[model samples]
Target: MTLTLTQTAAEAVKQIVARVPQAEDGGVRIRDTGAPSGFELSVAPDPEPQDTIVVTDGARVFLDEVAAASLEDRILDAELAQDGSVRFALGSQV
Candidate 1:
């Protein structure tokens, strides 16, 4: 299992963490929501116990075991909308 982040995504995450007071020393965490058959992404103060940590371009991404498996061989990217909002995109690695 692996998690990859694009340069833009890493920059975006860093910017967000800088703005969010509670996430100063934190990183992004991805977890699987088994019941809903989906994933949840949020900022965490640090990696939880037994989390898989992936560092990319200075951004730390923490993934639970399920999330790690789910996102294997995938890349995470960031896109900016016309309104300046950031949107995260996940794609399979080619």
Candidate 2:
């Protein structure tokens, strides 16, 4: 499975990770929530046994088996809204 992050997203994640206390040994985890058919992202101390690790330029993203498959051909992107809030976008690899 493959998961990618845009330059903007990578930069944003890197900045957030840097501020985390144990970021050096931890990474971000992305999980699929079957109930509502959505995903959740958070910082994790480490990847779980069944996680699929995606290493980007400046950050590491850990995805569980289901999440990895769900995002196999997707790209994670970040954008700044008019209100100055950060928004996350998921797109097809094409």
Highest lDDT: give the candidate number.
1
* Pairs that collide, model 2: none
Q: Mind sharing the TM-score for model 1?
A: 0.86
Candidate 1 residue runs with Cα over 4 Å from true position: 35-37, 82-84
Worst 10 residues of 2 by lDDT: 79-88
Error of 1 at 45 (Å): 0.8
lDDT of each: 0.85, 0.82
TM-score of each predicted structure versus truth = 0.86, 0.84
How does residue 39 of candidate 1 score in lDDT?
A: 83
Give per-residue CA lDDT, model 2, range 37-88, as digits (tens).
Answer: 5998888878999999888885788999889999998999998566645677
Give the Å error, residue 17, model 2.
Answer: 1.5
